[model samples]
Structures are given as structure tokens and as C-alpha cells.
Target: MADGGKVVCVTGASGYIASWIVKLLLQRGYTVRATVRDPLDAKKTEHLLALEGAKERLKLFKADLMDEGSFEQAIQGCEAVFHTASPVTFTVTDYQVELIDPAVKGTLNVLGTCTKVSSVKRVVMTSSMAAVLFPVTPLGPDYLVDESCFSDPNVCSDKKLWYVVSKTLAEDEAWRFAKENGIDLVVINPGLVLGPLLQPSLNFSVSLIADLIKDKNDTVNKNSRLVDVRDVALAHIKAYETPSANGRYIIEGPIVTINDIEKIVHEFFPELNLVDKNEASEIIPVIYKLSVEKAKSLGIEFTPTEATLRDTILSLKEKCLV
Candidate 1:
């Protein structure tokens, strides 16, 4: 797909997963119009600029999520748009301003440009698993979630699931806009994405792992799924390139408990000081499973859980992040 003239645009190019997408796109020889909040901020974009083929193939554009026409120039001639930008943070003061506005309004702003730009053929949206399930509650063992399910926004709001609410509303808006305007849209719903980050600082997902290792809290009782950041980026490309790809694809690895992660850490780094292994903690039973058959049908082989977790820790250590 990357034949030099095949241009694609990635919003929030300096982010954790988006950076990998930009890197992969540039390495494949595609002309990439990468949007950042500030293109001139060397500290944020230096790593991106240093990537292979970045000098010639990558063009940085200054774009903000809230601004109405901020992403238009970047999306002008692109064949595909990878909308990976969203305000993601666990700590929230104002849900409306911090999470909702940037997610819903920013998504509309981006898709609104697609209506004007005739060259855009497809859009691969970066939606989260949070859109599929409520944040605080675990799915029952009998409950299984696929593309068909959506998190109850009412539940999210009532429970103060701010981040989940943002993602759910944003993705809902994207689907509605695409259907109404005849724009082809594909959504990638990923679990907690973690792995080697091209960007310098640790992302929210990776930070959670760091906190877990520090044993700051007894979160071992909670069970959740994870996907490698690179795998998630690849899923975005696959969703865009595959002709038959339609609807939402859940890109997740295996469901694991926090104790499972601790076991893997012990196997990989035995010398490091870890939470007391002898501490008996109740194993959190898996409530439900996220279906990945749809993603696998598109020929995406997910990285193994152990390898994914190992790479995440090693990368954090290399960056002196953990």
C-alpha cells in the first residue's frame, strides 16, 4: 500500500500507538501527514523525526482536537485516515471538558473534514474496549462481548467512569457520522495496550503496569485483557488495507489476572524487588472473554501474552521509566 504516492494521515502522531503507526507507515514508504498538538515542539517530535524515512516521507502538521478545522489540511489528500488521537487519562477533574469534549467534538471535527475531502476512502478509528464494557464492573462469566455490544453510557456516567464515557461517546459519534455521510469507517477496539513505546514518556496504559509492579495497590484481584501497542497499530493498517474489512474489530490478546502478570515478571526478572510472592491474594476469576476471531480473520496474529508483557517491562527499564 505504501508506494510513495499512497498518502495517509495519522492524527495524534506523537502518541503511544500513533507513533508506532507513523513509524510503520513511514518505514513502508508511504507519505504520512502526521498531526501533533504542536509540530514545532522538538521535545515531543524529536523521536518521530529521528525515525527511518521520516525526513522525506513524514510531514508534521499542527492540529488541535477541539479546533473545528485543525485536521483538514492534514487530511486533504490522504487515501486513509487513522484517528488515534483522544484525551486519555484516569485522573479527571472535569469529565465534560477533559474527556468528553476532546473525544466527541474532536472526532466530529476530524470526520467533518472527511466530508469536505473527497480523496479519503476509509477511516480506521482507534476505539477502546472501554466502549464495549463498563469500567468499574467486570463482565459476568456468562457474558461475552463482541462487536455487537456497547457499554451503557448511562451506567458510565452514573458510576463516574469518565474515560469510558469519553471513548463510548466518541466512537458512537464516529459510527453515526460515517453511516450518515456514506464514509467507510472501521473501528479497532483494543484492550489495555502495552509494549515498547516509540515516544519518550510512559503512556497511561504502561504507567498502570509500573504502578502494579510497585505494588502500590492490591489490584491483583482485578482481571483484564491486554494487547501490545505494535499489534494494535498493525490492526489499524490491516483494517484500512483489507478490502472486506468492515464493522468493529476487537484487537486483544489473552485475558489475564494480575497474579498472572506477577508470575511472568518473576520468570523474566527474578532479581528485581517485587511484591511479596507469599502474600495470598484471591484470584480474580475471568468474568467474560473478548472475541478476537474477527481480527484473526483479517490475518492478524496477536503477540503472545508473556512476550508482550516481557517486552513492555524491558522497554520501560531501557528508558529508565520503571
Candidate 2:
């Protein structure tokens, strides 16, 4: 009943970013069909219902990432779909089985469904900055992977690297399917997504901050580029409107460090300990930084790194998480 098929479906609606996406869409008077693996699970849906006057405008559907036809049902009559439902596990033994199949296959399934659903005009997928911002060259401390870079799965197949492999392959599958099916798809690849978490269920992407806040490491260097979740959400909506934004859009800070994030958290929450003075295991996983030039050109604004970190601390405090 929405104008121009204005219904928007967001997969993984209970997630940190997807919840905010649903909130924003509902705030703008768009009917949002939010997908959860189990819609009846009151624990998950309760918080989402409480976000930004969402109780009435938001609808819930049971759409599992691995289950086919689930997305098809959720995406019915929707003009846009924000596919952000891939697993983000930290360790994996099989890239193809654990990471690749679900990430790639899940994306393919979504695209296939999008093709069947005639009303869907666009899809703003949540790809990671990991895919396009990784270095092809081997280890170099000076590596600040730009948008032109890509993670070479052949060169690196570590367990920790499997998540990157999944994202890269998943986005590739989406583009391939989009081109073949003639569906409009825009990918938003964010680097080390940070800022206030809207949901309790955060993927490993944002879990790094939580890990660091618990002082999981002492010498871990915080040098990966970061992006605010609110900005990333805005980027999704901006890409939906911008005519020239049908390609990959990487969102990130120029130079961000979790150490800097810790400093900010310490500013407001003085009792928090995001760092420890010990020689324990502390190696920051290397990930590609983002290039927000494309997004900026489209009028997307990014929050300052310090402000984002400060807000992150505040949000965690609000949730009583830290």
C-alpha cells in the first residue's frame, strides 16, 4: 500500500545495524518488513519494537539466512532490501563450508528471490570494507588498504581470514546475480564498523571493540580504519536515493585506532578498562580501511572518530554492557 512500492525489508533486523535501518525507515513513514530467524522470539523483537516509534510501523517475519524462500516471503512487494544477514564468526576451519557457502549462497538466494519479486527496485547490501580494502601484497606494516585493494584468498587462508573471504565472495555473488537478473543493487562496505550498537546481537565485526574493552589484549595496536554505525546506516539510505551510487561504497575514518576508542570511553566511563598492562596475547587482526570519497560525493557524512568512540562508550554504558 506504499507509494512506488515503498515497503522495505531488512534482513537480520535484530542486529546492531539492521535494527537502526528499520528504525530509520519506519521513522520516514515507510512500511518495513524486518526479518528475524524467529519472529516469535520476544527477546529479540522487544528491543526492536522499542526503537524510534517502531512498534506500529514495523512488521516481523521469520527469515533465516540459510533457508531458501524465507527471504522471498519477506521481500514480497518491497522496493528495497537491505541484505545484512551473513554469519561473522571469528574462527573457521573450512572457508567454503563455514564462511563461503552461507555467505555466498545466502546472497545468491536473496538475489534469486529479488528477481522473482517484481516490486523490488533496489537492494542495499551490507558488505564489509574487508572485501575491497584488503591488500594483495604480503605483510607490510605500512598497509593502509584503500578501496582498490582486495583480499587474495589464495594467498591467505587463515582461520581468522575466513570471514574476509566470505564477505569478498558474497559481494561478488551479489554483483554477478544482479547483472544477470537486471536488478539494481548497491553495496555498502564499511571498515571495522564502530559506534553505538543498537542491538545486543552484534557480529564479530563490532565484537572487536567489545573484545578490546574487556582488555583481551595489551599490545594490540588499534590502527584499522573505523566507521560509525549511524553513518553507515545513513550511507545505506543515501545510496538508495543517489542515482550515481549503484556500486561499492566504502565508509571509514581517515585514521582510527581502538586505542583511541578506549581513550574516549575512559573520558566518560572512567571505571572502564579497555586495556591491560600485561604481555598477554595481543595481535590486532589486519583489515582493509575504507574510502568514503564515493559516499561523501553522494552527500553522506561520517562522524568524527573521537565522537563516534565517545558515543560507543555511552551506548555500552546505557545497555549496562560494560
Candidate 3:
């Protein structure tokens, strides 16, 4: 185990990425205060409690993102806060009510609590590539998307890409709040996070993969910048631990298409039937690159796309999801 006496609070402890963050933090011997929607939810809390060292080092507290001051009890006395809790759904009847308010307001609520606690030295936030890349603009092949890029909320709203809008707005608010309050903030913007699932439920990204496997003709033509869940979890910790780390870091592996995923699935499990690349609909591949140099500087070497895909499929199989 790594040397860890520091106390840290992780919001949204029951989430796909947050669960891994909690697991990793416990492995390092940190006393973790994890916030979930309901501590009594067995499906969400059981796997967390089962983690190695969790019995001694992990504590779960109930916290609702939209509920003001709900995070205070969990965040008090923590040296650092890892704010990973946010809505991840794409299909919502009310985008503002279901996604935007929770993401933006919930973030401020967490930061507000942090301001009251003097022990908090830094806050590591989980933002998404959706904040960096959307509104569907055409870019040159040489144009590398970096942390500097911000998705246009106007465009996202007009396009009904409310999830992108929420992430973009929430991250924007976080930076503004951090600046005004003199808070040490580090944000990790991960691409489509795919790897082994720690939570019992299927997240949007993993569900996309599972849907493709279960359906012979369900292949998307868009390109996706992928990253392993474990790497994303480590990046959060790295951003928190590295003294010189600042601002935003884009965490991703490689840019791949749906066909690439299908090929990998076929390679690993030949018995499993998948959509043939030739039969899959093809659209003009988006030509752009994601810059991960800043994240790499934090000493995070990402997992290979093949290995991530393999692990993702294996995890789904283990859960009987695929």
C-alpha cells in the first residue's frame, strides 16, 4: 500500500469513475469519505464496501447534488475534495432540470462547502471531453483539440446536445468560482471513459459498447476519443497529488471509430457476432486530434485502446451484460 494518512472526500462515490477513484484512494491508504445519493442503497454501496481496505479506510455519506449543503458533512475535515458526481444521462425530458441544474448548481454547492472548510487545500474535479469538443464543428486534420477549447453552449443548446452544454457550463462555473475564492482547483477532462465497471449499473459509455455487442447492426459512425476508467481515476489522483499541476488536462487514449471497436471485439471473441464493418453505415470521419500532453506531464501513461476494449468486454461478460 502507498503511504496515505490524508483524508479526502469523493462526491458521487457510486458512479463508474468515482467508484474507481475511491478504490484507488483506499489502495493508497487514504481515509476516504465518499458521498452517494443514498448510503442505504445496497446495489450502490455494497461494491464500494467490498473494496480492499474499505472496511478501515472508507466511509459513505448520503449526498444529493441538487440539495444545498448536502455535501458539507462529507467534505468537512478533508484535505482535498474529488468532485466526480454529476448527471451522466443523455436522454432527459427536461435538460435544464435533470442535467444542467445538477451539474452547474451541484458543482457550486460543493465548492461553496469547500470554502467553509479550512482543511481543504485543493479540489480535483471531473469534467468531460463534452466540455471541450462539441457543437459539431469541422476542424482541419492538423487541428489538435486541447484544454483551451470550450464547447459553445449556444450551439449545444440549439442542437439539443444538452449534456454537452451542461458539462461546458458546469466546468466554466467551476473555474470562475475557484478564481474568485482563491481555491486550488485541478480539472481532468476525460474522453469517452470505457473500461471495467465497478458500479453495478451500466453507464452511458459502457452501455453504448454493450448495446453494440448485443445488437448485430447497432454501430455508430462517429469517432470517439477513448480512455480507460482506471487511467481516468489515476489522472484525478495525479492532478491532486502533483504539486505543480494546474488548470485543465485532457485525459484520453486514442481516437477511434465504431468499426475499430467492432474489429477489436471480433479479435478477442470470435464466437461473438458483431456488425461487419463493410455493412455498417459510413459517414465522413471527423478529422481532428486530442492533445493529451498536459495529462502525460502529470506522469499518466494511458492504457492501449486494444487492452481497454478487451477489459471492457471482459467486464461486461463477467456481469452477464454482454
- The best candidate by lDDT is 3
Please write out the lDDT profile of model 1 over residues 10-59, one tens digit for every residue. 99999999999998887777899999999889978998999998988899
Question: Each candidate: what lDDT?
Answer: 0.87, 0.75, 0.89
Model 1 alpha-carbon drift over 4 Å, by segment: 135-138, 217-221, 277-281
Score residue 66 of candidate 3 by CA lDDT: 91
Q: What would the per-residue lDDT of candidate 3 be over residues 165-190, giving only the tens digit for each residue?
A: 99999999999999999999999999
lDDT of 2 by residue, 1-322 (tens): 2344368889988887787777777767788888898888887888888877576667888987788887877899888889888887756677678888889988888888999998888899999866864446764556655555666655445535778888888887788889988989999888777788777654555556655676664323545667788888888877776767778877877665545656765778677754443333244554433346778887877788888777776777777775
Clashes in model 2: which pairs? none
| Model 1 TM-score, 2 decimals | 0.95
Task: Estimate the TM-score of every prediction.
Answer: 0.95, 0.87, 0.95
State residue 8's C-alpha deviation in candidate 3, in Å. Answer: 0.1
Best-first order by lDDT: 3, 1, 2
Give candidate 3 misplaced runs (Cα > 4 Å): 1-4, 135-138, 216-219, 277-283
Worst 10 residues of 1 by lDDT: 275-284
Rank order (by TM-score, best first): 3, 1, 2
Q: What is the lDDT of residue 22 in candidate 2?
A: 78
